[model samples]
Target chain A: MHGLVNRAIQSFVTDTYGPDRWRRVTEAAELGDFEFEAMLIYDDAVTEALLAAFCADLGRSRGEVLEDLGTYLVSHPSVEALRRLLRFGGDSYVDFLHSLDDLNDRARLAVPDLHLPALDLREEGAGRYTLACGPGMPGFGWVMMGILRAMADDYGALVLLEHHGPHADEGADDEADEVIAVTLIESAFAAGRAFDLGARAG
Target chain B: MIAEDTLAGILARLCPMHLLVDDSGVIRRVGPTLQKLRPETPMPGQRFLDLFDLTRPRKVGCFADLLTGEGKLGVAFRDAPHTALKGQIVPLPGGAVIDLSFGISLIDAVRDYALTSADFAATSLAIELLYLVEAKSAVMGEYGQLSRRLQTARISAEEQAFTDTLTGLKNRRAMDHVLTRKAASGMPYSVMHIDLDFFKQVNDSLGHAAGDHVLQQVARILVEETRQEDTVARVGGDEFVIVFDNLTDRPRLRRIAERLIDRLQQPMLFQGRPCAISASIGIAPSVEQPLVSPAGLLRLADLALYDAKHAGRSTLRFATPRPAEPAWTRPAAGKDGETAPPSAVSGRDS
Candidate 1:
């Protein structure tokens, strides 16, 4: 994983929790100093240990933690540049969903060594989409679901997201290949209006 | 459905600022955010390269050059002199879109652009790294201070241990160390063993406080008469030893001892009462026998001192080599019942 990915997790913990909490998590992980550089490469075991420690400290499952990280990446102002990059994909909610398939290519332009899991999007009905993620990342499908929900809020589209276990059909061999189904209940652009009105009232 | 203008407004809000440039590097469109960042409104026909200078991606020369480049580049706008912006330039069909975000120092960016922590990406770890460096520096500074204090205390303790409390001269222990060192060097040297003529009389008549005053004054006289390289130490009550190094000439050594005796004979006030005291000095020259140990040298000097005391006091004597006789043997009395000089007594004993 790129340093950017680890940094995002660190920021997710610090911003949502506090620096003290992050310190305790690192201590529980038996990591010393926990110094990280933006462009430096680190062992994959370090990230795994930190995540495991975080899961234990927070008493949450790994999937839930990753989902929270995904939500934080979009909502936090610290990741405003990344949110802008993701928003540049398209104008509408469905356009953004389709652009997910080429996200890794776009990300590679910024970081040459970045290797994100491949995503496949297919339109099933008028307002429904089927998304499949590659097996390269485990338990990351939940993070993708969180990102989709946040993107839906950004686009002012009401969506119903569901996760069916990897083998929805008899032909599926491994759990690494899983598909998520998304249904759009309303595209009224009402959420953005409410947010803007709240901002104005404040 | 969202209108095109509304979507563009949303995009502009997400970006720091953006500029649309033609193939000729002329500004074609300016986002509303860009208008707010600049002091003057940008004209559509103006050249984009003339308005902003590229700072990062050092290889990129102009706006046209950035169209062929990858990754983000830093830019400094002439209109906003103090602020630096960073982002990417994406090539379009006939032109390029330059998207800029503030890229100055974090402290300055926060203050100047009114940006909050939310404006920064969580991927940036430079802030936390700087904090750790500062914390480590503070700890090192504290440790350095403590080390310096400990060194000062050790030096003070060593000085106190080797100094005489009353006379402010080197004590017996310090003299022992110096004599041992000099003896090991096998250099020609001389030792003067001095005893006050009537130190006990001053203490019995005027009390020990006046005795202490006289002793301090005597120490000052001895230090003043001797050369800087000599070592003056208080070895016992009313007894002092001076070690003069690297001197072998007898006439010069005798002159120094005579001057010390003359100075001690001068009258000095002790508690507002005139008091007079003299010193009996014994010289032990090491020119002929430089290999003598410190203890052997002290015993020879003491024998010479006994000779000086028997010669009716307030006089000086030099130790002569006596191969067959021990230093502790006392000189014999004169035929008339008075103690004879060292040479006369040695002759009588032989």
Candidate 2:
């Protein structure tokens, strides 16, 4: 089945590009269930949430949308259709997704060892991009996927891509046992320092 | 390998659609959820930076961005170019930089009306809370900037208001304000005037540059000899005044003047080289037997200073002779010579 998917994708790319396109599209897949991919793409409701969090960063909202370009989510096609399927119900999902980006960014940045670069305009490209990775066990891939897809529909013209899969695995699984469930309040505060505590480094 | 259960849970929650290589700037994968969003663009595992400029550290290539639909959180991108907020970086314990971000969403009428009754009830509350927070954040940011600006202004005004830039002594206005405030409290006050002898000749011979050096050193000497509480002013090109308030006795004033003459007599070190500097000092007591206004006290000190210049350069004179006289002027006798008469010591007006 994996071979079949790869062949189908390669054939489609070949037909689409008379081998002239600089690159070809082929499936780099794992021996996982079809639904496994689906599950990986849209499954955040199961894990004991590391932190129940909500954040509202004002500066990014009015003045700028995102300050970190490195971790910024660039959404495209597949993301939009899923959003519609998830019953987002019109623009309500738009606002809800935007709010989520604020929340997600807050948490990612607060991680003890990550200082992602800022999202810059002088540096942003015409295409959108997002890093989607899941460390084999207890991966953040789903969360990354959630952000990427929601982002896709949010902008019709912009193209955001998430980098995910086995290769992208951060390999953080066996290192830690229990997942930490932070109070939604904690994640909000943790992430919203961009908003809370008002202007200080780190 | 990401945890199956956890990844499943988060994926169920997020429904993320795209992924990019952390390094090498490649499109590592794209989940099925993303494919449905856009019917076209086979974006799976495509090199993102391959087609555009991702190499430059801080530049914008997009004007508008967005992420929409359900299972999809309400994420909206802006139309403005992405200007990386460099200073907005928030650092985590291990050198992690947390950049600033916020999301804005479009309002849909159906969705607006479809919220659960409970969720609906909280709708206004949530929006109000959000607005309150937004307003608060704006105010806080502005407040921080304003605080910094005000502190800088205070320092600048203070610098201009209190001390002389060149000599670092109390300026005339500052001295007057302090002394006047003290004088109003009925406190005792005394004034001393020190003027360089033949200062004009020094300026004429060595140039104003050397004269400035001479003045700076004299200011240092005067400041060094006086009490911290006293006021000193370089009121004129070659004239300086010192006011000592709340002193108890005559011996103290005499001792201070003696010290002034003895120390001022030492050769001045101007601009890293030796130069000569000499002064005539006048002292007037601000005692109760015959009180004088600040201006009048200064005038008396000036007269006594004139006598010192006549006695000899580098001399000290006290206002003991012709006490209570409206115009106090008399020659100071150098211990090495006899006192000169009033006419002998009188100098021609410059």
Candidate 3:
């Protein structure tokens, strides 16, 4: 894995939880020094061990930790460039959802060595879309769900999202894919304007 | 909204400063944020390359070249000194848009650009890398200090181990080391054994402090009278030894011993009283007996010292090979104040 991934986990734990908590997690992981270089490559086990230790430190499941990391990716000041890149995807929430298929290519422009999972988006109906995530990254679907939620907020769109289990026949295979169904409820900006009008009238 | 208005809004929101230029290098547009930051530069018609200097991709000649280059480019504004920016150029319909973000040191970026934790992202690991380097530097500094202290302590311990505390001269251990090394080399050398004649009387009448004062004075005289190459050591109470390298001649050895005794006989003030002391010296020349070991040389000098004391105090004696006779026999003093019968003063026979 690239050092960027490890550093993100470090930033997430240090910024969200605190440096002390990060230190404890690293200690439990048996890592004497946890400073990672941005362009360097590290063993995949290092990231796995850190995630496991972080989960143990916070007493949370791996999915929950990944989801938190996803949210932190968009909101944390340190990753503002990534947020900007994500925001550059499109002008509207629906357009951004369609742009998910090109995320790997866009990410490669910044980090050539990055190997993100493939994404497939399908328009289900009016104000609805279905997203399929390829295999190889465990618990990454939850992180993506969190990012989608934050992206919806950024677009001023209220949304409803759901995750479905892998197909029964595909479950026996080593590479089982997961799916997420997204539905836009309403425009949050319009709702805010309505509230403003009500306040003025009162 | 018009397409241009949307583009301008995006640029103003995302970048602190930006530039839009045509293919002919004419400035087509300047972001409002940049206009606000640098109000002095002519915005609409000025050449973009004229105001900003390209610091990266050394071969780039024009703004169009920058648009086609790989990765980000570093640029500094001519009007705004010491401020740098890093950004990429995106090709547009007729020209290109240069999207720029503040390019500064990590510390300066946080202070001046208002960069927060979100800016660091997962891809930025510079802070943690710098922290590790600093920790290593601190550890190395502490280790260097510790090493220097240890070296100083070792030198002090070595000095104390081989020096006499009272007279500030080399002690018995230092003399023994020099003698052993010289003896093993089998080089022609000489040893002078000096015993203070009336040191005990000084201690008995004037107190040990007065005796110590006299010893200090005698030590000073010994150091002054002897050559720099000679090793003078206080081996015991009221007893001293001197080693001379390559000075085995009998007459010169006797002269040095006589001069040392005369210097010691000088009056030294101790507690408002003048105290007189003399030395009985015995000289053993290694050239006379090439086979003598360090221990054997010391014993021979001691035997000669006994002869000097018997002949009378404040005198010098030279050691010769011992005669074939009982080792306990004492030689009688002659009328000339020398031990009778040269063969009777033999050191090896004794």
Model 1 spans > 4 angstroms off: A166-175, A191-202, B1-350
lDDT of 3 by residue, B188-245 (tens): 8898999998888888999989999998888888889888988999988988999998
Number of clashes in every candidate structure?
A: 4, 100, 17
Candidate 2 residue-wise lDDT, B1-350, digit = tens: 55434643453324333333323334434434333233365654554334223222334343111111111111221212222111121222222111111222212211222322122222223333333344344335535665776799888897668677667777777766766776687888788888877667667877888788777877898889888888888776777888886873668887887787777667766566556666788887778326566665666777778767767667777765344534433344444444444534445442
The per-model lDDT (C-alpha) reads: 0.71, 0.43, 0.71
Worst 10 residues of 2 chain B by lDDT: B63-72
Predictions' DockQ, in order: 0.02, 0.01, 0.02
Q: Give the winner by DockQ: 1 or 2.
A: 1
TM-scores for all candidates? 0.38, 0.34, 0.38
**Docking class of predicted structure 3:** incorrect
TM-score of 2: 0.34
Tens digits of per-residue lDDT, candidate 3, A1-202, equal 7766777778888889888988898889999656665556788788877888888778887666777788888767776555555664554677678879977765565566767778899998887888888875656677788888877776778999887755322234427677889998875553211111001110
Candidate 2 interface CA RMSD, Å = 16.9
TM-score of chain A of each: 0.87, 0.23, 0.86
**Which run of 10 residues does model 1 chain B get worst, by summed lDDT?**
B126-135
Candidates ranked, most accurate by DockQ first: 1, 3, 2
| Native A-B interface contacts kept, per candidate | 0.00, 0.00, 0.00
